[model samples]
Target chain A: MPNPRLFSLKSDSIPRATIQRLALYVQVLEDLQREGADVISSESLAKACDVNPSQIRKDLAYFGKFGVRGVGYYIQDLIASLKRCLGIDHTWKTVLVGVGNLGRALLNHKEFKLRGFEVIGAFDCDPFKIGEEVSGLEVMCTKRLMEKSHELGVEIGIITTPPERAQRAANHLVEAGIKGILNFAPARITVPEHVVLEYVDFFHHLYSVAFNITLSQQK
Target chain B: MPNPRLFSLKSDSIPRATIQRLALYVQVLEDLQREGADVISSESLAKACDVNPSQIRKDLAYFGKFGVRGVGYYIQDLIASLKRCLGIDHTWKTVLVGVGNLGRALLNHKEFKLRGFEVIGAFDCDPFKIGEEVSGLEVMCTKRLMEKSHELGVEIGIITTPPERAQRAANHLVEAGIKGILNFAPARITVPEHVVLEYVDFFHHLYSVAFNITLSQQK
Candidate 1:
């Protein structure tokens, strides 16, 4: 059982790992829902997520009391609760900077739209790329980012620029009043305390695989 | 100082969090080396990595002793050691399935090649996609996966197929003698005990951003 008052507290009070797990739970729950599952026991859910059953119970407990004795959690209700906790119940307007191959793939990525992130604009500095239509949006000049971001009330900025240009692109997005940034460039960029930033490191998993394979071979 | 004997132990004895931090340290150290820095104190490295100085020291200590008392660590030597620890000092052959937009972007991504992963083959089931050239590799029928994988000595498989096809792709890769899999589709997959699997969840970061943005707004 969890203290109901914990839900009213600021989000920082909750561990980020817990929040990330909650996001993952939402993903798993949605899958179950698609499979026509009406309910799922904590043990079953934890198995699906590759986590301990008690860990699942503890994470959900941080938000509020969930599930019923012996019966487990109702799939639809649990999904709604987790989504609300993750702030994905409503659509988030986003602007993408850079129109390179990775950028174009992101624009065409249906998962973003399905998950409530709407890429309202795409911007690039290349004159050759400007005015080009990609995934339905006309590629706009990077100079117009601020104006369009404001006009669209964009909340998040996605950076897929080259490493050399990443910092400049982040600067433009912050200047455009974006609240969050997801950087795909293999470069580190600084942002203000108010703005949140996450990196899409493409090599981390590969390194893990390499390390494990090496270890297995050694044994 | 770390016990030198720990370095000879199997990698599982090491915490995954430590391995992940080591991976991050490698990234930060590489950046520093590129910037012409020859030595860096743990404090500086920690600051750049957004981790505590003591945490950096603790994570590095698991492998072996690092850094000098005052002059800190030698950047070039440290990178070489960390890369060797990560098993990325040598090249790992890989193959990519589902030559979609995301797949095409990955083929053009220079980071994989730079980080020692050679994408030796591109594969798809579509007749129109088969025989098409992408990033210097001809798209082959998925049916030939095992033959080509054996010929190329591929160790890793990259899955960028749609959610519905992801499991089948994993099955194909496993049968093709892949030692590890990196799945990009938004689906849960199962692989053999000897084979490792990782997911590129594009939605996790977006969910984090949404949660944080919502929290910030409430504040």
Candidate 2:
């Protein structure tokens, strides 16, 4: 059963692809802010990000009016607003459930930490890994995810377990009050209502690159 | 200067996010064909993939129409049509540069082989891995990528080298007549006008998932 209230607040008509670009624009704006860019017009932002100016304006307009017709947008204010819209304004506590090679590499990635996310807990079935510290994030037992996650009020979860364990880990993510899930596992998963699940398929993406490259070459 | 032919073929208007879903739809269609499903509608395909039905229609409209007014699309015919559009009608010989951990993982992945693309050749500067066999693919010296890629007319190049070597590998791809590149390295690599560069920003994607989940859970 879906927690009917989970997605009640967000714009239901916003294309997910637009939501994704919002994240990308936010990244570029964040970078620009670091470089002391005070004001940026749609044209400037689109040029830097290799996007069309109209597309940038359209994507932003989905939420509300943020751009000034004559002056453009304030970098700091737009960043803050985008962050809040994309749901990254506050620190989010989450658990990583794989601890595999990719998972380990991700924990060490500075970008995640910089994006207001903390890999506060990680879990793996391997006995040797329990209680170990990986990239300063504590490794815990897989069985303990529910307990730790609930106590932490984790609303988001990252699942990187093997395809075999992916479904089980996702179930646990749902049970632990996580309404948003980012699954890196290779398998397809089904989720109950009230939860938002995003699936990133590695092999599928690689295959797509291969296919597109082939087509572009053919042309 | 960009090869005018390739430049004219490139359209950045279609969002990469939408292209990704098209790839997913192709896979789902293939699966349906394998399952002996005769005809599939937009809603059926969307339901199978947990996406909106109108999205399937809209994304398909970008290339051309396929849906029947009432009978739906023929599974095999649509699969073939998508394959043609995606440029995967024929198996594309590909090269993987910078045989690092991620490279090795992708090389070892059976999914590529299953999708009609073959790694065929792998290149890296690391002396120890050169001439070694991993994932049933032979590792070659990075220095010879241009020569071999030319001989094979490698159409697609996958860059898994560190951020430092990303540009170098991308240059090699372009010089060797590789029109399509899937870059896994962290840094964005510039390509010649004729080349299509798609960034497989694993770290960026990871950060997005972590950050967005946190944001979505917000009030």
Candidate 3:
């Protein structure tokens, strides 16, 4: 069982960087578990994650200590603890707005289901796509977003619309009472202070790569 | 014109956080320019980007000083300088290795071309997909990756293959003499020291959102 203190720790007390690292550690640990590794030393985990062992120790310590001295952490225990810490231990009711090529790809993405995000609804504004079947979910008109979201109790909304429509999609999601949004569009959209918004910007990553490649050449 | 000193500086001297901020600033500036804004006060830019004005000034200062006394920055000049600083001033010849749904969406992503990343080739191992048209480019067999990449001078490789196939796709990309890779597959793959690898993990963002929502509920 996860330490009760883990859930009791105020989220504001945790650094955003630590949460990011913890999320990454969960990914690395899942891979390790799938590979049939029962236990992993901090050193090995650090190497796999490309981070210092001490940093890993610090990140995990923010919640509670788990690794035994000299023996390392049990893969199964850490995975469960990290999942709970990340609030992904239970399913999150999710809705995806926009059924474009990108939106279709996201609907078919297996990882979201595997990671506890259940996309219960798919909505679009295109009349042509309104009745289309995509990844087992029938595309519904954007008008149904609020009613369906309320009826289904959607907790997260994903926007994969074009740049021009991103903000509008975000507005609809907010009106639908979504608590969180993950936007994959190139444009930036605003949400209420109470709602959490995150961007999946491919260009940001590409720009970083371009900079690093240029830097490597300079060396 | 950007200062030659910007390119000459050692990449190691600039922190990774600053590079990320610089990329974000470019995006914000581009939006401002699109809206016909020629000049913007640092306060407004900071508010738009949700960062402190001092932080923006500090990030821009890492490359070279630009903002004038009290007048703030000229949007066009800042965008050009930041783009050059981030090594995206010129087109980067790129290739995609997975012709799956995500790969197809990426090929159709207009922002890539608009932001100076030109996809020169799209390769996949699926026999059925080979020779199919995707966003104007024909999908070729993965076997042709090396030859086509070398012949076309490809610099960046995008992997949208399934997790089980991600490593193989990465190996093919590395063998194709690619300098950087933007992997959208939900798996981690290693690259040589000279190559830059970045992951577009939607799960990471979703997990953060989940955590935040859970925290907000507690409040």
Could you tell which candidate, 2 or 3, scores higher by DockQ?
Answer: 3
Q: Pick the winner on lDDT between candidates 1 and 3.
A: 3
Give the CAPRI rating of model 2: acceptable
lDDT tens digits by residue: candidate 2, B1-219? 112232222343555666677778877787777778989877888898778998888877767778789888898888777666665666768799987766776776666766667778999989999989977877988888889988887878899888779999888778888867888776657887677777765434544554444434443
DockQ for all models: 0.49, 0.26, 0.61
Candidate 3: residue pairs that collide: none
- Candidate 3 lDDT at A185 equals 88
Interface RMSD for all numbered candidates: 4.9, 5.4, 2.9
Cα lDDT tens digits for candidate 3, B1-219: 222334655325776667777888898898889889999999999999888999898888767788888898999998998988899998899999899889999998887878879998999999999999999999999999999988998999999899889999999999888999999888889888888998888788889898888877777
Query: Residue B67 CA error for candidate 1 (Å)?
Result: 1.5
Q: What is the C-alpha RMSD of each candidate to the true structure, in Å?
A: 3.8, 5.1, 2.5
Predicted structure with the largest TM-score when compared to the true one: 3
Q: Estimate each model's TM-score.
A: 0.94, 0.81, 0.95
Task: Spell out the clash pairs found in candidate 1.
Answer: none
Model 1 complex DockQ against the native: 0.49
lDDT of 2 at B166: 93
